[model samples]
Target: MTISTTSTIAADAADAMPPLYGLKVLDFTRVLAGPFCTAMLADAGAEVIKVEPFEGDDYRQMGLQVDGHSANFAFVNRGKRSVRLNLKQAGARDVIARLAGWADVVIENFKPGVADRLGIGYGALSALNPGLVYCSISGFGQSGPWAEQPAYDTVIQALSGLMDVTGDPAGAPTLVGESVADVAAGMFASWGVMAALWQRERTGRGRYLDVAMYDCLLSMMPTLVSRVMAGAPATRQGNRHANSAPFGAFHAADGLFVLAVANNRLFAKLAEVLGQPALASAPEFATNQDRKRQEAALARLIEDWASALPVQEAVRRLTEAGVPAAPVLSVAATVASDNAQARGLVVRQRPASGPAMCHVEQPVRFDAMPRGQTSAAPALGADTLAVLEALGFDAGAVNAMQQQGVI
Candidate 1:
């Protein structure tokens, strides 16, 4: 089956130019980390050609589906084209080599040595295209004692000491709600790729990036890591801040709210907001360090006042008193909030063959360039023929390859 190239550029030509408008990315990523990295590039206007296996990305079948397309897949794979190639076949290497030659950057999250075994490792691709900024995302990086050990987000979270400091002090270790390790690795990989691209412009050469989920998660916990390194045992504070007093979730009349009394000033304001201004001057709460010593007492005092008021009212009173406070909003409430709408946080994109879908826009913004339009994640092999044609393959050749099950 042949697919048209009409959906290649989702954003209109008249829209503001994207930062990576002329950039070309060859994406051999499957799941969250690699796809998310490429998604950022694609959102910035890079032409990302996602090379998938013949059966498609495993993520496409792993989550809630809209018209048979996975919503999770859509969230991370938007604004990119999909080209399916059976890399196990002998004929597939040529296609990958051609794409590598055409690309400015290539990203993959294959297990260590898998790409090399397939003859498409950074060494091979950089040889074919000397200026390629290749990024390899993995569980434990290219060389490590645990490099060969298989890992998922939870595994990294466990090993990175993130889970150790996540839950209530008396509770079992808790996994964060989202895939923090995977997302962090993806974010860091994008940073590495961008830095490499910038460096390449000056040095006239490419570089390889080794981004590990474990390392990225470990890097994310600077405070916790430093504390542990300094001989402090890891402590789980749950919703409480490690070094701050009365800085955590508190129950209100209607629901939960969070307030941060980061300094003495904020604590004083919080005390005033709770209608007990004298508490700010109390010997136990006079200073942040003293308040930290009596955090349970402070929390009780604050909660006593907060529990009488609804979350919004408590938040408003705290705000008026110059204290930082906000209600705890669920995901649904957050997405529908006025702030979310005003900031264009949610976007709509239509896939080539499916109904329109909503996505969260990339967070970064450029003053000179308006946000680009969104595109739905492509169907498997949606751009196989088009990508092959772009690689100088004729329709007859593509047909022959298809007949041979190479794509």
Candidate 2:
């Protein structure tokens, strides 16, 4: 749905600056993780300058393209200005140094040593701007035995034990439906940047943040960590939770819906909705532990009752009874749901050319700050001349650098 730009709320929001207004971000990330981090900063009203190679970020050419624009690129790079400069070119180093000096935060996702080689490493930039918060997003981390090894989202998932516990118990390990590793790392990186920024405000010194995809994903899965730490091996349990019974997908007449009966109260509610109130008091199903021990039997009972009803109808009854339940929805369905609409989860931005684009807005709400609106992702180098001129480079100087194949 289109956002109502003329609404009083919209007009008021437009007049108010966001929380990160005036924050300067130099984004040297490509693909998902780094771009995702910077995208959040941009959403908070940071002025993000996305640095790219002459060919632009790899995401521009990596995913589904609509009339030559990469939807994935646009999804993550919204509200950022694009500036193309060849990092390998010596002349580009001068521009990067200036950009780093201008930035309050810098994010890079290159391999650990690549930024150092390019002269945009934390040591170099922080020397120029001691108050700069520098964040490096990587698969393993900035340093470790596996630091130099190349890592993709899938690699991190597998290496981080995420794939090991994601699929059906009887089936082979499976990757998650989306790039959870990249997204987790990006989220942590953004958090790290903000934390560093706050610390800088107190200490009058910036900090270096090393965010690893593996570490972040591992941190996100607290249950898995707790189980392993307790000497219990984490295993795939299909759609069921390892610790809780009646807390996973159940079959309905039309399809699968999920239910969560975490405690005895919820279990009683679920039993009541299932037309089996006595089941909640059964010796084998009384406590959460006892119910988990009979999880398969519990599942059969749930399926038997649910199988007669449609998915949504089953969910509605369970929900109305105070048991957490919901139909399994596709990504598009979730995005377009009434709840999502009410929360303004998806925002529409009209590009200068082509159809309007939809982006998932940053989820947090701040009472004093306005919801952020975004410009479409920039064309490659669209802001280079303007940005350079703003940096005090004359048009002639910028043109000369361009002619030298530096930008």
Candidate 3:
């Protein structure tokens, strides 16, 4: 297998405009899913204005904090200006109206009907700006029987059948290490916004997008979805591919390494590397399905060979022989690896105050679009005064609103 590190592209355009340079986004997302969606737009050069409640986003108080900043909040809320508004306050509606009129896009992740109650729903805002693209992220879709029920990442994972297909077959169903459901919803929400934006360019009218975590997560599991649709039940198979043998982690002398042999040709190569080429032609291991039936025996043979070699050596031998293989690595090791550095996967951003922060950036590469211009996440309501003033609130009105706890 060849790994090409570079691609040819045309030179930058004369304007040097960022992908979403002139876009205006009003972000009402607080936690992972909605915040993550808006954050992607901000990274693509949209001018994102994040509106928060007086108490601020819940994530700011939920995760690891350093220098009075939450890592979780910073990771998802970076590159946006923040404004605080008490939506329950009567005076705040005026500000929301002005913001709605000013924004090209608005995204929220409140439970269904909550945004309507707070006057930030699609019907309310789109009325102010008919060209606005409004997106709602939720656990279940709007208008569903379970739409109003509150859900977190774990709840969505469990409900989506993702948890049911993760972990070891012998063990109980387990949650994924990361918040896959939330991330899936965020990704789909961003895609929906972009698609709506493209459509609005032609129609001269905006669209309302409804994104559900459960739906997005379900769509992400192609293998399990196919199996279940074909009359097979979903079941956990640990770190292995459910339908393939010799395609999971195997123990080495020092640690574990994963291998993939998806077809007879790859299995022949793997068998050759193990000095057991005859196994490839054996009736019990002749085809992928046959090998799967004898998976336990196959694993024993491979593990017996690998158990005497270090993981790196085993991985190197397998890779040299052209069988897909890799040593198991921890998160820290993977982030600090040479590949991550060479690809510029992790980036550092410095806020106006506090120590610099490091995060993994979006992986897409555009030849003409420059990357690595990220700023740190804003402090809660840091731009409140400036934003209100920009929306035509004079000093006196701003002061009175603040005094009355409206902002």
Candidate 4:
């Protein structure tokens, strides 16, 4: 089972040197939030070891499959190694302890008390390696009234009042199409890890991180919450901005488009683009306050003009007129658009066992360089033996652990 270090593939010289190169992360996480956090670190060139149960991460079977691997899993797991271990097995504790000693960071998303019961909690591991940055992502943080209550994205969104301000004004509350809360928590957790690492460099000490989906989502509700704090009622305005006029979707001859005529200058440009330049000088629509009061009438006039033109023509005319506008696009259309390709926003990779796959590239750049090429997600336990050997385990020991179902 042991793999010789000499046989390990060396990194390509042509690839850009990643910012997190040589950082080692032990990822004791699965599903969305924790996986996403570690994935970002891995994308930055950390050597992330994803430790999973023998049956593999549940996300592996939750979404669309490509050659028997989940596309969802692939999206968040690329650029990492996988090591299978049954933490319930007595022998697995030793394996986890060893990996803990080697890792600079350990991130887990287990519900409260689970990690402690499994003996891989912060206290146990931090005792073994005090400089190890341990991050725990949970539904409601490590200590709270709802800490033990299970939660998913929708639940967090609803509880955080995000749903209350989403969707059409007259419609039932709607959950965001994507898992915003989970992704936010993941992003915050990654930021926390980096901050902790930076501080450790100065003080020679590691810290524990408690990231909560509820807290993250609530933090993102400043606009709505702040309004309420100022004694304003919270209400949904559909696609419209609460304080802006003509700042939402409109229909064209062929499809839907959006505009953001936030300032008088932009509103004037929009009026000129609509062939009603005099409307800009009209007292009823001359100022932002005036437009806000007559938004419905103004939107109707713009829509009447746009409804005569195709979405593309409408968008082109608006752009040329110096007004910000865009046609609403489907997910497929977005990925295929020239703008996406020009920005290098999508990446294509061919896995050893699956068809070529396309993924959204990390939306970050360093030194004017986009993220480096990423490897395909690993198959379950694909690098167990190699990782163990890299950890100094010999062939016989690896074989014994495997036979005992500890890895």
Top candidate on TM-score is: 1
Report the C-alpha lDDT of model 1 over 86-163, residue by residue, as the tens digit.
888988888888888889999999999999998889999999999999999999999989999998999999998888
Off by over 4 Å in 2: 1-15
The models' CA-based lDDT, in order, is 0.86, 0.86, 0.87, 0.86
After superposition, the stretches of candidate 3 with alpha carbons farther than 4 Å from their true spots are 1-16
Give TM-scores for every candidate, taking all chains together and pairing residue i with residue i.
0.95, 0.94, 0.95, 0.95
The TM-score of candidate 1 is 0.95
lDDT of 4 by residue, 148-236 (tens): 89989989999999998889998998989899999999999999999999999999899999999999999988988899999998899
Show model 4 residue runs off by greater than 4 Å.
1-15, 368-372
Q: What is candidate 3's CA lDDT for residue 323?
A: 100
Q: Which stretches of model 1 miss by more than 4 angstroms?
A: 1-15
Task: Provide the lDDT at 373 for model 3.
Answer: 69
lDDT of 4: 0.86
Cα miss at 80, model 1 (Å)?
Answer: 0.7
Clashes of 3: 0
The sequence of per-residue lDDT tens digits that candidate 2 reaches over residues 263-365 is 9999988888878889988998878899999999999999999888999899899888988889999998999899989888888777767556778867888
Better of 1 and 3 by lDDT: 3
Clashing pairs in 4: none
Clashing pairs in 2: none
Query: Model 4: how far is 372 from its true place, Å?
Result: 4.5
